[model samples]
Target: ACTVARQKSDLFHKYALRNAANLLKPEAYLKPLEQKIKNVSSILKNKEETVLNAWHYRKKIIDEYLQYISFKRNTDKVFVWIDEHDECFVSKLEELDINDEGYMDFVRALK
Candidate 1:
């Protein structure tokens, strides 16, 4: 899903670059703003597989934790909770640490 989201964002970037009527756009704007292309380049680069795996792992954990706690709150704010502490949720929960890092890390790394 993170891959998809990045792809979609890149798609949008491509389209916008194609249709851009003004200055170069975000990338262009960022470069001079930062006075460094490397900074902007790093931001634009796809994440390493390890980082992407970590994010996927993080997402899976939050999703499970959300499901686990959904009924307890009147108006569940699952996304925020998931976002804030996914590391812990990923680190300890069975669903999140599916890899059995003695935890859920395995599950998160699957795909």
Candidate 2:
């Protein structure tokens, strides 16, 4: 989804650049702007991958935590609590420290 959004933004940016260039000079070349667009697109692509990876990692931790909690108490009640406060739960999960593991470090690295 992030990638798609970036692509849409890039499409708009490309046309905007072309229009401005045309207005300034009929023969104006857009090679420089094209290169910049490519650079920004590459950056967005890398960031999107990093974000998706972080979400996957967070999901792994949340699943493990849910399993642990479910075993200790009522599964339905635990699920309801998780569903009710999903944002809070995910935020806590993102900051959670797992033993000596640097899970929060990974979350912090997500751009």
Candidate 3:
């Protein structure tokens, strides 16, 4: 589970940071990536103690995604995306059962 989560996070970073500029609609990539992270985090949640690295990796992915959006000068899209999926994102964060600074900072930033 940990390995899979790391790989998925890595792939998300690759696309989000490296290939994002090439895409005409970068926000189009956000939903799927979000879903993938949610799924991986869910799996890692069950093994929380043993998979601490995976949770940290998940945090890194979120940080990188935020950085990517800022780099593209599309900060507004972040709010739009959150608004569109606010409940889902918040609920997933709650379910993860991890005290991830990135996740907390994200929620705080949204406020």
Candidate 4:
């Protein structure tokens, strides 16, 4: 039972991170957000150690993540992804509606 609970929690975090990775500002939040998520795995290794549960932890992480993304915007920097072929892909962070079918298809192709 305990093992199953841990497995479920691990799966939840994995999916959460995967969803976050596809977000527009993911380049800014990925590293620190990953560190925050590692806390979940840490607790599974040592149950006696107290760690934030998934809900509270995820909310806190999201709040901080949004702040981090917003902070980057103030710097007036545009994130560009360069492929192995040396092709540059430029994106406008604020303009991304996250609902564009064409853009989603392009992103899938890039992966």
Candidate 5:
């Protein structure tokens, strides 16, 4: 389960970093973020089953955490930067009204 857990963490970090970048000022550790992405890729490369599980777990965590995410008032548009590697993995982000604040605030893979 270590492999799965590790990949899960990496995925979480990536999602957190990406989401943060979208809503807040960029921080450091980008090199580590890149490394974690590679780590998850390596883990998934050798274990295909874990890859699918990682995707699902990522979706779950993102859905849960994003409800509390609030964009700064300066925001006008949301830009998604898709990695070429993740293009074919999941469907369009299933945008949802998770915040229940009269508008949608979260996006996840469709179940």
Candidate 6:
């Protein structure tokens, strides 16, 4: 689980950075951001069950990115995705038992 979490986290970070960089480019030169966001979102959705914290972190990154973009553009599409994913991540976090030995070990290893 930890190994999978690490790998997913790495991929999320990579795409998040790439997306941010692309966003900074002039509009004419920018790459499509939707694909990068989708990639990270898919990773989070697929791995959330096994690594909650890692999923949380990656989801948070994508949420922030969406929020940032939404603020810059007049679009409702991004909000829809944010609302849907927010429910899933929140429910998962609520289900977590912080005192569990395995969970603590996973958190420690992440540190």
Q: Write the per-residue lDDT of candidate 3 for residues 6-92, one digit (tens) a residue.
A: 667767767675676778887787668767776776666566555676778899999999999787777687768878998887777
- Local accuracy of candidate 1 as per-residue lDDT tens digits, 1-111: 445655665665556555544665666654454444334334545464657788899999999899877765634566567667777765566543244453344546532
Residue-wise lDDT of candidate 6 within 22-79, one digit each (tens)?
6655333334544554576666666665577777889999999999997867556666
Instruction: Give the poorly placed runs of model 3, Cα more than 4 Å off.
Output: 1-4, 7-11, 48-111
Q: Candidate 2: give the clashing pairs.
A: none
Worst 10 residues of 3 by lDDT: 42-51
Write down the lDDT of every candidate, Cα atoms only.
Answer: 0.58, 0.74, 0.74, 0.63, 0.58, 0.64
Who wins the TM-score comparison?
Answer: 2
Candidate 5 off by > 4 Å = 1-11, 22-27, 49-111
Clashes of each: 7, 0, 0, 0, 0, 0
Q: Which window of ten consecutive residues has the lowest lDDT sum in model 1? A: 33-42
CA deviation > 4 Å runs, candidate 4: 48-111
Report the C-alpha lDDT of model 5 over 1-111, residue by residue, as the tens digit: 656666687778768777767654456556567776777766766677666788899999998666545453223223232344334433333232155433322223311
Task: Output the worst ten-in-a-row residue range by lDDT, candidate 5.
Answer: 102-111
Residue pairs in collision within model 3: none
Instruction: Candidate 1: give the clashing pairs.
Output: 96-104, 97-103, 97-104, 97-105, 98-104, 99-106, 99-107
Candidate 2 has a TM-score of 0.50
User: What is candidate 6's CA lDDT for residue 42?
Assistant: 68
